[model samples]
Target: MLELDGTTMCKPGPLNPSIRAHSSTLTNKRSRRIKGCGALWGEIDHAQGVPAMLLISIQTLLRGALMVGGVSVVLAFSPLPVAAQERMPMRIAVEGAFPPFNYLDANNKLQGFDIDIANALCETGKFECQFIIEKWDDMIPDLIAEKYDAIISSMSMSLERRQKVAFTEKYYNSPSVFIARKDSPITDVSPAALNGKKLGVTSSTAQESYANHFYPDMKKTVFRSSPELYKGLSDGRVDIILEDKLAIYDWIANTKAGTCCAFKGPDLVDVTFFGEGAGIAVRLDDKERLARLNEALKTIKEDGTYDMINAKYFPFSIQ
Candidate 1:
């Protein structure tokens, strides 16, 4: 405390007895206050009539309190405001080789049923989005890890997968079938015809499921992709390939083996083996994002965009 010792200032300092005594008194008071506060900062008020250090300390405390309070509020409401929600380009994953569902179009673009539907969804949901190609087998694991925000590669809805990822209602319907080389002699075949022959299918797919369930007598050969399954048939490694009907028709129509193979027999998709139509796959944790995707899917299906996407790929409706 820099006290203005008013009683001692008027006394002369040339060995004046009263002046020496007053100076001693003032020193005592300053020492007492400094000992109490452990600071010379609290002495400023006595000299200047107001303390800048005290005001600064008070301001710092208030600011710190506000910071803690703000953190608590943010923690309590993690749902950020629209602007605060991190603005990121939505990434949609696709199985790049699946023609008409999401193949590399002639122009080298991801174009197909899934691609168009996903674009419309981004537009309706007001988000910037991009599509990236990935293998089908990696889709679920990648999606769960948030490698992409969603997948729109004609992934089907099943009770098993539903336990892992969220799905929209059916986007479009199609059937599954088998493609056999015309010379293979399996085209004129029955489900029983595959009894001893090796039939190829994509692993973990509806085709694989149907093949195992319906043709339990056959040797089931599973590959990682539909193209690979077809390749196995082409190389005579497998008698035929079981997969999506439209995929078979499209590939056979577009390839050198066009004259060599065809989709033989009726559609294997009877809800008994193949589940309902395909839908977009989303992470299970993103309730908000999932809701937006579902709404967009519903709107497109109703306003005929989805049907148009259907017409571009499949010729007949699934009953």
Candidate 2:
């Protein structure tokens, strides 16, 4: 007989034939069973001549022991269920210079839409997530080097990036646009119209790719961060800047320093330049983690959590 929980006792013997037959029926319908302990315990209660309480106590004991490094002993009986295993904490990388999406506040703490969305995904997935500040250019290399498990910065899912990492379905989509001084003469925003004009773009971004691909003859000034890119336009270091339309709108409509600039021409979008939209990126090999993030993203969107976060950041939906 095996003693469990210092109270329940059951002999090691085959279950009664009738009980075994009944349990088999339950096992066959496992997929339709209601989730959680109650449904399982209720089914056990109906097994005739079997000590259901003893089995429950034993399961509880094994679970407690496994938590304290008894894996080998538990494996002797059966492998632990995937759901029973503790999940490793995830480290997420974010660029702390992009405002409204992600940025460092006055106290140097990370804040903004990206941070909030990352937190919501982690919460929904029951993951312990830690955010690491990384340079926009270094995010992918750092993730590949295992410095972080994922990059939650507003990274576009461009083809070049897809080759290096896997991206979850885009959390939000926004178009790219050009921004120039309100009084600037360059209105057409074409390569020919702006011949010899200096263009500002953040290095390693899709905007830079677009500028290089479309305006090879135009002079280009690359910046390392969004704030620097905007400053280049405001301080007259560059004649014009191209960036995400929503981000440009956030700066122009919300900040006093952005008073000098306004959108130029039409929204610029190309499947080759911006593959889809902003997505959370994980290492190419981390498929399990990527799937979890994608599921959590779907859950948050369905449960209205995503809408709350979106509304807090923007007046209209960016999805």
Total clashing pairs in model 1? 0
Q: Can you tell me which runs of candidate 2 are displaced by over 4 Å?
A: 1-85
lDDT by residue (19-53, candidate 2, tens digit) is 21012111212111111111111232221222569
Q: Model 1 clash pairs?
A: none
Estimate TM-scores for all models: 0.66, 0.74
In TM-score terms, candidate 1 sits at 0.66
- Give the root-mean-square deviation of each candidate in angstroms: 28.2, 18.1
lDDT of 1 by residue, 12-40 (tens): 11111121100111132211200111011
Residue pairs whose backbone atoms clash in candidate 2: none
